[model samples]
Target: MATDLRTSELKEPVDVAEYLFRRLREVGVRSIHGLPGDYNLVALDYISKNGLKWVGNANELNAGYAADGYARVKGISALVTTFGVGELSAVNAIAGAYSEYVPVVHIVGYPSTISQRNGMLLHHTLGNGDFRVFSNISREISCAVAMLNDAHEAATLIDDAIRKCYLLSRPVYISLPTDIVQKKVEGERLKTPIDLNFPPNDAEKEDYVVSVVLKYLQSAKNPVILVDACAIRHRALNEVHKLVEKSGIPTFVAPMGKGAINETLPNYGGVYAGDGSNTGVRERVESADLVLSIGAIKSDFNTAGFTYQVSQLNTIDFHSSYVRVKYSEYPGVRMNGVLRKVTAQMGQLSIQAGPTPNNEIPQEELLSPEPTITQAWFWPRLGQWLQPEDIVITETGTANFGSWETRFPRDVTAISQVLWGSIGYATGSCQGAALAAKDLAAEAGADQVPRRTILFTGDGSFQLTAQEVGTMLRNGLNPIIFVICNEGYTIERYIHGWDADYNDVQPWDYKAVPAALGGRPDQLATYVVKSRQQTEELFMDREFVDPKCKKLRFVEIYMDRDDAPKVLKMTAEAAARTNAKLE
Candidate 1:
């Protein structure tokens, strides 16, 4: 009994619970995030024993959101739930993870296999005794799904689920029966790391595709590089940077790709979204003889509702698994390798895009500004105050659309669920992102510059998951939260109702939210800014975002209820037209 459990020499068979948790630790899980249920109580007993802290969230949906946020920063994250109800409550968050390519392992503890087979009704089930329903639903959203009924195969199942979560950078599902929680399983698989075999490209095909892309690059009179969200998801930011630098091609970022490439780069063009693009960006890209697009996701919000003018014939795409050059296609040609090859040979190519089209980044005009903050005045100023190494999470509201225009500082990782379009995401995601940043900062030693985890959310979105603020407080995480006080669903208003009562939300005292959410007064700082003068005083103050501050800060900024970013307004019009009947 006294033998050290941590020692690898012990080679003893361990319970399935120990096996599962230890495997997660080996793959870089520092903590587990979820709500506790009766089905998982026994499994929870082994959490602290394995040296992992349980991040008890206020609800399953928020737990899923937090876990997704954590996974985006930490490389992979796991969430534990119980049976059908708890797991189903997190489905929306899981879907968001899938759309955005965040690797999250969602584990569900269910009734024993004996009960399921005997048709015993379970509390969380629909009373139909059909245990396969939830798993079937999960299969649609997850890259991999495994339900473990046999102890002998549990190790391999768990390993497969974890590997899928990483390889695809998406959510994976695992079902664990209650009776199997303590079953004995082999521990030998723990010695070797998870075998994540990503196959290499075919030699001849790889060379052919690379040559085709390079030939276009050298011959084009105006070649443009377009970077999008996939560049961040596939871990190709470094390669994209090298390609842009070496080719000397003018680069533009899609809305989903706001923070992937540093905006300060000399050849950096402004944001491009068809009709919503910055001045001169759309014209330059559409006029190009060839466009080198990397990880481009053409979501509605990302492309201004598919208003793009660039043709497929002039576009050469570098995707995660394949390459598309004009009309020809090359499957199994990995982009990671292709990008490296293209970047290395850039020195031999001739430059084409002339004079490097430029536009002056917008600056806030303070003269005769509104008494209350307006969307136009605020976003630009917010960008001016951003610092290096800041982690930003924006919700799917005015914050999401407005933030696309802001130029981020160097190393600032901005996260927005534009493709998923989930409201209330930033509240829970900021909690997870902050914890990840804090954990990474601690690992970097005592002298590392502190990284800020900041959240920009609308009032309606905040109400959906404000309880997560308590989770942040409990963990002693310091994140700056800016709640946009626009009265209701402004984004929804833009799309459908201009003055509908359904779009209105109950107003609450925003400053008292922290205390109502169980945050101690001394542990938090609150601010309510109603005027342009006040907004400037707070964000511009160097002491407000000071790295030395140890308390979480919350700020509520008031703006017009109908106000929205110009790009979002345009997209909303397009969305309305799409929803309308034949004219």
Candidate 2:
């Protein structure tokens, strides 16, 4: 029998929605990202009441993307949507977050339990009235799912979903029924926070793995440390930095791990993406006798279309769940503990002089007389202008591939969906990243400069999520956005259709978009650059770079339709071959 709130007087009973929002606040979710739907409208009221900001996104998909970005910066985030239509619309974004190991709690609003019990057809549901179908679909991508049909179990389920999302570092799904939104649950549960601590590895197993890693470290003549996206996802970057600084081995990052290491370090080699790597990086990484690979995810894009040449016999792989030393496998042992122990116990080995990463633009491109903004000239040139601790976001286009050449300053966070390859993700992601940066800056007080969220996206991709700019403006966020106006999907063109009509996109006055999106003229700045000199002038502008200027800086950069970054060209050619007929 259910505990009737009207009949029985329970002490300190809390609404289900209030409990959920409070839990989100406890987990560092300062803002709730989603659009209000009819089913979820009442629940939205609890967001601000629980000390959380409600980010009303233009659409559900963009909301999901924004939540993903927030999670990448703030550790965890929440998204709310209506049951079927809204939740289905955000599926692609949720899938992308799952693919990239981002923790976003996707809370969906469903019809009342009474409606479902009577099999009544609902607006957001299928005609068959099966309420579980949507959640069934979500289980494919989500690490955990909580169906809140019963008020008794609602609080427990919500806690479980959120904990799994953080521990597993992936998306989770929660279904909140309309009638259940205000259902009374035990308020005392909120007093005890969810356990977010990772379970420690078995002491004996960890010791053995650490010793095995140490043995290989001492004997190798040439050893290198390769960091990847998982190092950031699994929160092992601190351990990675300690090992890199203490060991002084040649350190390199995969394409997806661009910002994991400090580029100023003496042992920091540039990105090592097989054929796409700078010649120095490829040769050094491939020739090494020993490689300490931390949290590596060698996807096609990450490895430059499956071109990584590192041998497994020479590599020691460290992962969140386990560590592999050469051919030996150590299961149930986590990387954080193993890496910490390995760094502490390891002795000195042969430390060779490694390549130093730099941001110097190529001499030929700098001296070129061409007026058009070429990829080769723009990427390295932009590197010179980037500041410390900047949050740089790149779309899955030329911007993503081109940015591999740019060496980042200390503490800069690079956000991109490289493995998922989701187009237009950067714009929406930029909104959440800017908000997170704003929150962080406030916490740091007036002494520290606020981190700028900069976005580099192609015109075609920008058109997909342009409405997100309006949301950013409404929130008073300051982000520097660059739209590469090449007139089409340059990446797809390079892959299959060079001159096909399918790849072409209609041109728009991108500079006029913010104003049309309701930005005040005084608060917004727009620019158009077609030449290298103009680009340089904009980069050096004092007002543009000033943190005090609280304006959205939007720039439209024009380049030839056929021009693409060198790395993009190589990777595109490889992708084409992979899609070609077998011999």
Candidate 3:
């Protein structure tokens, strides 16, 4: 029996900050990321009081990225910042969250209602005393926007904004006035908690879409399953896995959906990166008569510059909002529910018997540990060495493209900003991902093996948000940070200037970053690997891979300044041609 969350007999009075924090806590936000500001200081005080720790980031932008990472694992996360300057600083990360469908509640602290009404000049204001400008800017990126100026109706607005954040799986904005932080409000609404139950499906639309999908699926001689980024966003991975297992169809994941499915499955093919796909991935997907595409996000990076060859006549696109079978589309039919039904009814429906998916990745020669580590040798070794449930965070430049060919384990989770394609996002997000992994481990019980967080980033990207390494140390996180030191923005160099000074970056003592970033030298190990011999030794070391190590490790792997992954090289040439032609 379900516990009735609503209670009409009792009501308590609580401050606005208490209500907000309590509500966030109820929804599984253990740590709130933010930068301290006078406007939001009072609210920050309530965080610890409510059993939540404040994850003080080095900057607001980092806080935003960290919040996004946490939300990706915990389902929802919160980030607090000052009204104007602080909020604007985080807008880029918030926009990325909106694009990627991560639920993050951006709480901003604003001046009091009196100051706004009187047009008083404030430090964070635009000098004209207009408080509405920043909120207007937020409206464009957030799914819902709310200003908590009226204490009487503040609860409703807060609940509504948070609901939109979770339901849409995107960012939402909440502006809390300084004076409203401690304002007394009735807490009767808190008894019910935030309503997280998704809306019921329209039976007719669901049935119609399912039937159409079955029709196409049954008739096809060769059918395939393509999972995309939205599968993880919409929480449809389990259902998708079931559908693939039951249907016994060949499955291939898009670039952004690298870890959305178990790559170890015999029917699981490699990533689909348009023309850049591995030897057989693109051909197998395009040649299929019927394609089941779940939660697809067709960004340029994921689709190899919009070069997908699949046609509408052979595609069944299952999206979060609707489902499409060839020429016909059913509105308001979510795949989350429909997939479970489809999986249960798989035997009753028709399906094609096809060849098992080829799970072969390009094999590398058994090189004797060479003096230098090349792209050819590094990525394949990393893929083969990865353990189950090790979360990998790749930066936008070489790391992202280099990770494309890496096969993940059964429950591995991969994180990247493919759609937003933001540089300097991985380091900050790595902090949150590690913390979330810790929380997840605790929840899984002592018997469960602890999950490790591994981050692969380039030199240029790391320079932008390098301060988060200190935050990680302060929080006692033990992530393996691999800095690919190629001496510059190699990704950019591949696009325009092969040897342009503008693309050059100053060399850093990457191995010293851990100790320099407040990590105790003894508690951390730093190593520089200029050869395959060193990399293999470090990767195979028990201290680096085991949970009992109890220390973070930073490894700097050196490569040629002009070297880059083949996929990135190909994409760069294509991008350059398009740019030269003004396409």
Candidate 4:
């Protein structure tokens, strides 16, 4: 095949694999996560050469989950997998990434163009001649899809796909044919970086929306700010914080928004999940005359099974695409610009000061005088032990619901899959988050302390992706992992099958996993605590949480299988009711 004449004009020509990896490195991806297959093996070699670390995950699904976690922490991530089987294995994770707002570049190594054109049967493909079936499946979940069969078009497609992934904060798919991996493209394109700036909203429409928001705000006697998942995913935390502090209005977060606000603020209320809200948060938010909901995603689980009592008539919702004030919708008006204007223009408000929302854990919720580790006690206690800037990842089960009670310290990031609710997501997410923390720490140099990555997962959920722990050890990442050993899927049991065998999971020796996965004695630490006393002792121990300690610390806490968080019980019952509805 003759090379295109346009390619000969370039001073520097690089392989297609080199261009793809370089683009990923340029877009803040320090590491690439994936499992190597025969098709993708050659492309994997270009990862390290382009200054990006290759994180060989235990499996493709785990790789996808790890990529999701990495993106949550690092703002963008890249995942490489082979054609049919590997890509299909990761579809669930990619779908989760799409449902929630996460930016992950999914790169699939495809069969050669010749094989695809001739309809030659490939080992990983279905017996059918169609090679586009897998890409079609990905199109449903991905924000953009790029097929790199032509060398001339590969650079343009790669750039477009990555930009879409970053700007949309959603997954994008790219199919790289094996024959095209070594094809040369203009290396000069590397000199110019991809355009990442979000297009500016219309000035006239933005002004109108901001004015409408102010009109409501200036008249609101009791206006409260509610933050949710999109606030973090959309990169609006800075604006959200400024609004929270500048306005001094009582503020609260939904379950998915756990770490979006600073808990230490006097006006900062706790999680407000409709019926599952903290002690007084439900009443405080419900009684407000005006509500400023920023980046709100009122999913069933997020809203405590759609139990939110806030009326749309009393709410002003600011979203990435548009602004909704009462029943009026301002299309094309973005929240970031609108918020900046709202905060800058407002001088003062003629609003009555309300009582501060109570964030205190009720005295009755404290650890019982008895020896057991109840859900209520353990969650509240956890808040007291967490440090600033901690990266906390929770599973979709008990840990997700129970964490609502744990108020985060300033700058801490909470990662969970509330909307997607994938079972084994946390373990793989932990590995990626830990790697991101390590990377950030290294970039910050020796003077700064690396933020700790802590994971809270039920034994049942942990069993699904436990192999990622081996990946963590292989990479030498130090993260504190707490496995709640309740013998089965407690969350599932609470939903319907109270004592059914389907909800049961095999009990494994959680502490022995690190050693079995090839951890040296000094490289990691393990503990099993049954009583509240032991847990408290371990938490209070200075040596266990010392910032200087690099050992991977794993703790197994034994709790009764029947016990669950109060919020979980309420939410689960609601879920059960909704699921059984004949309508």
TM-score of each: 0.95, 0.98, 0.95, 0.98
Error (Å) of candidate 2 at residue 335 is 0.4
TM-score of model 3 relative to the true fold?
0.95
Q: Per-residue lDDT tens digits of candidate 4, residues 51-83?
A: 989989999999999999989998999999999
Tens-digit lDDT track for model 3 on 339-437? 888777666434444334332333553544447677766777788788888889999878888888777777888999999977899999999988887
Residue 363 lDDT, candidate 3, scale 0-100: 54
Could you tell me the C-alpha RMSD of candidate 3 in Å? Answer: 4.1
- Give lDDT tens digits, candidate 2, residues 163-249: 999988999999888899998988888889999998999999899888888998999999999999999998889999999998899
Better of 2 and 3 by lDDT: 2
* Cα-based lDDT for every prediction: 0.85, 0.91, 0.85, 0.90
Model 4: weakest 10-residue lDDT segment is: 351-360
Q: Write the per-residue lDDT of candidate 1 for residues 308-340, one digit (tens) a residue.
A: 999999999988888999888888888988998
Error of 1 at 94 (Å): 0.6
Model 1 quality (TM-score) = 0.95
- Residue 211 deviation, candidate 1, in Å? 1.0
User: After superposition, which runs of candidate 3 have C-alpha atoms over 4 Å from their true positions?
Assistant: 1-10, 348-370, 445-450
In model 3, the clashing pairs are none
All candidates: CA RMSD (Å): 3.4, 1.6, 4.1, 1.4
Pull out the clashing pairs in model 1.
none
Candidate 2 wrong stretches, greater than 4 Å? 1-11, 446-449
For residue 254, what is the lDDT in candidate 4? 95
